[model samples]
Target: MTIISTEPQLMPFFSDAFLEKTARKCGFMERLRNIGPQSLVLSLIAALSKGNCTSIADLHRQFNGMCLSEKHTVAYKPFHNQLRKSAFADFMKTRVTFAMVQLIENVLPPLPKKFEQFDDILLQDGSSFNVHPDLAGFFPVASAH
Candidate 1:
């Protein structure tokens, strides 16, 4: 059962202090303008929800409906294009995953894979596609033998 709320509540609970601290440490505040570090977080979440999403029109209709603060609202085709097309998603995911790897690498007890230092290398991967039914045509294929 889904209940509706009139109040614009926060979906992912994050603290302003936490964001400010991380922003200063990671130097994200240098590049981001107008919006806060948490804005990047919200956009990242929007982008993920926008899987198979192409074009900013889709992004606006999809993410803008969410309960974001007016300042957090994303607009302009350029913003969506920049978020989905640029290396932003990959970069964010890489940073987060790498941090987790570094943390859990030594902690959280050990597992069978932990013993395999030979394959200790960690890999991060990403992909995207369009919602268009004819999207497969966009994929490249090498000539068959």
Candidate 2:
């Protein structure tokens, strides 16, 4: 069982530049320049990494521990409003992908000490359903070959 740390220490791989690069790749910061100077995306992710932010208030508390500058201070309501924006959702999806890739790269499951042999058996409920040829495109199956 792997015990992941709940500490809010910023990892080197998930640095500001790394996240900024991802944000840029995902077009989270594509257009106009009149927005706030703070990197809310980084703040949000860092806060979430700490395992403390379950609600708006908790997020606000996490901001301080995330090492955000005083100038980057953002209230819960405004942050929540930004989160509700569609653009933020896209950014989050990209972040999720990055995290998944990192996990896959870093985590290796332990090998069994001794291989166990077991009989192969297949069991299924006695039921079948018909599929229309026209619907094959929507429900494609693997080729038997």
Specify the highest-TM-score model's number. Answer: 2
User: How much does candidate 1 score in TM-score?
Assistant: 0.39
Question: 51-110 in candidate 1: lDDT tens per residue?
Answer: 876755665555555535675566666455555543455545555664556545554666
Task: Give me the overall lDDT of model 2.
Answer: 0.57
Off by over 4 Å in 1: 1-15, 31-33, 60-63, 67-74, 77-95, 98-145
Q: Candidate 2 regions off by >4 Å? A: 1-13, 31-52, 64-69, 106-145
Encode model 2's per-residue lDDT on 76-121: one tens digit a residue: 6765666577766787787767566666654566445553343453
What are the per-model numbers of colliding residue pairs?
A: 0, 0
Each model's TM-score? 0.39, 0.48
